[model samples]
Target: MVPASSEATPRKRTTYTDEFKRTTVARLHSGEQSATDLAIELGIRRNMLYKWSDKIEKQAPDKELRAPGRPATDELSEIEKLRRELAKTQEELAILKKFDAYLTRLKK
Candidate 1:
């Protein structure tokens, strides 16, 4: 009888890119095919595909609002106004603290 070890072929490790993983996860989410079927067709394990799908879902929120251009003029103005207000508030607080310290020194 032939040895069982000799009859078995070695399996190679494969690496997939982010684009491929995203595409595969998208297909899996479409509900067209079972994960087992897709994994088998793609020559990868079902568990690996599941992991990829989970990762994609977890990162979906972060990927949703990717603005590819400059901020709006109104947003820029609002930010600048808030920054100026914060600086003015900080300066006023500093002045008040200095006055309080001077008053305390006078009382001493």
Candidate 2:
């Protein structure tokens, strides 16, 4: 049995301000540094930067979502959305290439 005195204390959660988030997202979009480099500089996880960027980009031009409290219509995360898009694009490209090959064969 572990003694109560030996239990580890919980770590504090870190929070960033909206201004800081905007600046970070801007820097990310500027192409001056990679996400890894920026994250390392700011002492945050690389994926955290992506999360911030996604949320910021989806906000209204006035800097707020239409319904802040409502759940997202699409449940997928930003990364998953991009992943699905990439997969669909690749599938279309492959089909086109195959169709082109068939057309070339018929022309022969």
Candidate 3:
């Protein structure tokens, strides 16, 4: 068997407690410092700060953490997820077709 390479192993995601996340998000919202600066100081990605804030906004007090795209449910059913994707793809296709028609008119 080939030896496992350290580089090939994925790093585990760092998990933060709700209280820590809550305080960090609150500090960000307080406007004492810019989000980029705060992220640098805290050694976290700026986008993660925004994500935590969004989650907090959607959560009821003392509620379990609710993931994005999952509200009041363990997870969205696969069919529902697929339906959403199909709808989005249909909208994109419609727009592209309209754009193509517009360009064809321009070429005439």
Candidate 4:
């Protein structure tokens, strides 16, 4: 008869909390130290640090404490307003280009 041995499975990766992510991003943006060095000190990968930085920049918020679930109705309205502004700006740009073309033709 042979003795049976149990095998250990790989452990799941642990995710950093929102507060930790915010603190790390702040340290990186402080301009007082190198990101790679800070990453090593914090025992996190440089790639992860960069990913977190990108997320923070795109989100443009220090924290996402907006309660659980979908965004608030007001937040959706703000997003729609920004979209409308962008469309208006694009239209104005197109009109300016047409006016410039007309002026160039007149000059010629």
Number of clashes recorded per candidate: 0, 0, 0, 0
Say which prediction, candidate 1 or candidate 4, comes out ahead on lDDT. 1
Q: What's the lDDT for candidate 4? A: 0.77
Best by TM-score: 2
RMSD of each: 10.1, 9.9, 12.7, 8.8
lDDT of 2 by residue, 1-108 (tens): 999999999989999999998888888877799999999999999999989977876773543432334344454477688899999999999999999999999999
Q: Lowest summed-lDDT stretch of 10 residues in model 2?
A: 62-71
Q: After superposition, how far is residue 81 of candidate 2 from its true place, in Å?
A: 18
Show model 2 residue runs off by greater than 4 Å: 1-6, 60-108
Model 4 weakest 10-residue run by lDDT: 61-70
Task: Please identify model 1 stretches exceeding 4 Å from their true place.
Answer: 1-11, 62-108
* Model 1 residue 81 distance off true place after TM-score fit, in angstroms: 36
Deviation in angstroms for 84 in model 1? 42
**In lDDT terms, how accurate is model 2?**
0.81
lDDT of 1 by residue, 6-91 (tens): 89787777888999998888787677988899999998889998788667655565533222243444667999999999999999
TM-score for each predicted model, relative to the true structure: 0.47, 0.51, 0.49, 0.48
**Runs of candidate 3 exceeding 4 Å displacement:** 1-6, 60-108
lDDT of 4 by residue, 3-60 (tens): 4555556878989997898788778777577888998899888899878866765565
**lDDT string, candidate 3, 1-108, tens digits:** 666674477778999999999888778777788889999998989999989977886674433443334344323466688899999999999999999999999999
Minimum summed lDDT over a 10-residue window in model 3 is located at 66-75
